[model samples]
Target chain A: MPKSINPAIRDFLDGRIWLRLHTPFTIEDINQQIEAGHIEIIQGIESKLVFMNRKSYTCNRCENTDQSKFTIFNCAKCEASCAYCRNCIKMGRVASCTELIVWKGEQPIYPTSHTLAWEGTLTPRQQQASDDLTRSQEINRSHLIYAVCGSGKTEILFPPIFHLLKQGKRVCIAAPRVDVILELEPRLRVAFPQTEIESLYGGAKPTMKASQLVLATTHQLYRFQHAFDAIFVDEADAFPYKADETLQKAVRKAVKPTKPIHFVTATPSDKLLVEAKSTGGISIINRRYHGHDLPTPAYISLWKYEHHIQKGRLPKKLTDWTNERIKKSEPFLIFFHHIGFMEKAEPLFQLIHPGIHSVHAAHPDRKTYVQALRDKAIPGLLTTTILERGITIQNVQVAVIGAEQRIFDKAALIQIGGRVGRSSAFPTGDFTLFHNGITYAMDEAKSEILKLNKGGGTNPDELPFM
Target chain B: MNCLLCEQPKQSSPSWQSLIAIEKSTLICEDCSNQFKRVDIIEVGDNIDSITSIFTYNEAMRNYLHQYKFLQDIALAGVFSNELKQALSKKKAIIVPIPMHPTKKIERTFAQVDELLKAADVSFEDLLIKTNQEVMGEKTREERLSMSRLFQIKPQVEIESTTYILVDDIYTTGTTMQHAALTLKEAGAKTVHAVTLIRAASEQ
Candidate 1:
């Protein structure tokens, strides 16, 4: 005979589809749950994740061919031959007999009538796009918001998300990058103070409790299956997420098989747009909420900037740019292409101005340094494209040291420019590219910004007051 | 050939000088192998005469063992075979494995310690059979202490009064090894020595 489960536990475990239970739960309690059929133990740590016959093998997660990654061995725990997936082995080996308790019982219903606490108003373009998203969400159909950089895409997502939350539908706002989640989490929490929200990323401590709204990275979506009623993919066209097929599949797998998926991005690849437009309606927001134009970038040649930085000497124009920003007491972000050059250039720029710092994706102090910049404790930061998105500083100036590098694709360049003029108080900033030679990507980035401006933007000349 | 962990090609210095420093059957490159902290504490208490373990079970070794044992990357059994062999008795002796019960063997599929010996090409007898089917992991330390008689010599197995070299994977608290050594000694083996690949390093 099985005992009735606590409702709190059910709500917490439901959307967590597949999760590992290590210490804290007594084995007797686990056995009782197993008897109750609330969750079936798939495989314990002793068992292999994939059970294979001699002829063929398959991975249940990611669904890749079991080649070099899956190696078979006579397992002592299961007393049988088994294979394991090497691809996701880093995420804790899923061998045969590995104990994976899955949520197999009824999911929790979270009906709420609370209205959104966000008092800010959206622009007419943002309002129209939000309405379109609401219709798409109602019909459980996919939609894409093809907004340009600095076009207030995050704010536009608020109304539709609020509508779904009131109707008791589970909503997930997934981003390809962790930095984006960090940037959006506080704002979303502020907007929906009455809603239970959870933010998840690689190192984030997962709040196992049931949440009406979830913010997660696409990589974190692997542990989720048929979880969300509506999934919104922010920065949908970012690197790895756009290039990697597995992450794309994870987004699809995360939501209920038939539910809606919305993608919000400033720069959408042609293939993504074409595919999305075929199945869903598309809306575009090309102007920033303040009706200001995207910053127009001008390129200047610095033929041997690398040599100059390594020799502890910066080019005169670059030095003058740094000094000018320092003199004006304005915060700035200088984008670098290569990590080695970025490191070498950091100290040189510090000599130019000791108040400056540098950061990269792998830096141990990246989060702290970014926070320092946000608090106005640092005058400027020398960083890689890691800061090109997810960071908004007041009246921050932008410059790309090696804009001609292959790493600075048109989309990345657009994002780098988008870093400027985000706050209404600082609706204008200098967007410059210091390049060895003008490349097609640089021109394409510039033309894209110009195109967005031509679509719908206040005349830059008339914004002199800003 | 490349280092298995870092995948860097093995760098060779002047030939003769490097050859003497390099051990034959060394699978990982020199720098990668250097990361494992070699332990000086080989033997524990009086019950076990002599023991040899290669690496201190530090965080790195813990992670490596986690991948090998729990992750079941059975291929790693080959990675440490040579190192494990050098730590074992060189003299002629019967290699006896600390057997897991049928229940545990069914769950894990392969006995981790036995696989380590097999990869080293050390001839061993799987004669020590586990009598208890209870899991050590789910029990308290007191329950584990009560499990002193969990293993026994297989029936009809001839005890030749010869040397016995017992094999196991980890030596945590020395309980599991003590049980195996005492079993072999009482069964009329002249001498009993044990070899473990990693021993638990006291926490900092």
Candidate 2:
């Protein structure tokens, strides 16, 4: 005999029955299975447990029994091709798995989930901020929520997003990088378990149907025409998007005429901040969620390196720096102005310290080398500007081999400096610049750091170097 | 006669157009025209004459031309073509827009003369093809004369050379058109003449 189960759980299990069974079932396992809706309990052992369930979905053209396998379902009504997979339905591409699990349903049709709730516990400030944003949405007033880096900005939007989803409003979160979209996907999935959240990017699932909520890069918004009720542009001052007019137009064109647009950034451009302040829509949350202070920048000059390198000699300053780090068994990154110069310096530096390893963009084993460095399998990495953003390594000091080169603009120099003193465990380290002469950009970057130090909103005690 | 080259009047030739004035001497106009002619004709490959422009690039003409080329005022190309259309209206030949090299077309977006010719409502054929050539060095009239045999006719063009008029944006020194004319003649043409948007006015 098997126990009875609720119809909703039974329906869910019926759709995904393969998840339930182990072939030679024990008596106890069978009873548990009946309770779990895997097998229906019968009154008599002699009577067979008949599996009775309606076909949830069927391919009209191929007549395939498995709904999960077919993405391109032929429609008998219009004789058109339709996507059955969730990703395919959202993005129109059959790239990810084809599990026909209903995340949400509306008016007897399965509606894709866009806005989801936050499952994790929120702090008092975050909860309040979330509530404030939700209330602003109800009144149709645009609000700018400015939170510091690592301030759980995404989590704070969950409650507002959930409210919007309940109200059947379409939302979109647009960022400048594909990496940011990828990071937000899983977090959103867990929060809106019932909502169909589509991650839209160059490589994301392709579909013709508009998703309720789309997490996309700014470029992806070009195809959307006033589709979203609320559009959130993350990292508003990030490169390519910030500099390009087409991307700005796409962001504007993707949002509905009467809907709200939210801009989020750690560093907003002067133009954007001015506009936000003038409109009185700006709200600032100046503290990190983890309550840590932003890192203070340090500058070092190795003027003798160029003179020694020209003479086919390694500078004592570089050798001594490496030797001390080796003695301390600490890892570091040697940033270079050009790949050609970096290649020349690599072999010579390796001769001085045989254990040292260098990697660059053109290296065939770049991924392996990066992984090795990340895993602390190598002593150091000699690299170009490619590794300047969106990558973090534990406890690694940073050195710019030719910091005075014109390529090291203020933004680039600041980003490179950011790579150092990031981890809380090893939050303080020496950031050196090996330059033949100091440049104006370097001075500007250092001055900007001093300005941030004096800004007063940041925690003064945690910035050890300051 | 006034010399076409130097614009000096010559007493030897009484006819106004029969004499060409050199810097220091007068040459007979027939002799000057013959000197400009080369026995060997250069072929305007099948892709080259697809869109031919008229207007000898000169200092005076270049001022307006810089506006068309650099400033991206495509409207000026239309104006230049209207002038060209007016010049060619007397003749009954199809207006072949000068074809730009594929690489040049990509950089410049649209060919200027092609747009001009089309705007003028003249019938044109995309017949000539251009093969890339290594620029040897700056060539003078004599050097260009010697190098006149370099261009070759593309096969299977089926051109009515006698009725076809070779068009180009400019006719500076008439070297390119001379070669193009020779090539058309080799492809069994009966007669060939050149028309440019501007002829350098006789200086004298």
lDDT of 2 by residue, B11-96 (tens): 46344443442222233243333333211223333323322334434554554456445433333444444455555677766444
Off by over 4 Å in 2: A1-119, A122-148, A203-205, A283-287, A304-314, A323-329, A337-344, A348-369, A405-410, A421-423, A435-455, A458-466, B1-204
The per-residue C-alpha lDDT of model 1 at residue A432 equals 91
Candidate 1 residue-wise lDDT, A45-74, digit = tens = 232234554344455554445365566777
For the candidates in turn, chain A alone yields TM-scores of: 0.90, 0.63
Native-referenced DockQ of model 2: 0.01
What value does the interface RMSD of model 1 take? 2.4
Instruction: Calculate DockQ per candidate and list them.
Output: 0.46, 0.01
Task: List clash counts for every candidate, in order.
Answer: 34, 33
Q: Indicate the worst ten consecutive residues by lDDT in candidate 2 chain A.
A: A99-108
| Global fold similarity of model 2 (TM-score) | 0.50
| lDDT at residue B174 of model 2 (Cα atoms) | 57
Q: lDDT of each model, Cα atoms only?
A: 0.77, 0.58
Off by over 4 Å in 1: A1-6, A19-56, A61-68, A90-92, A98-106, A203-208, A304-321, A338-341, A353-356, A436-438, A456-466, B1-204
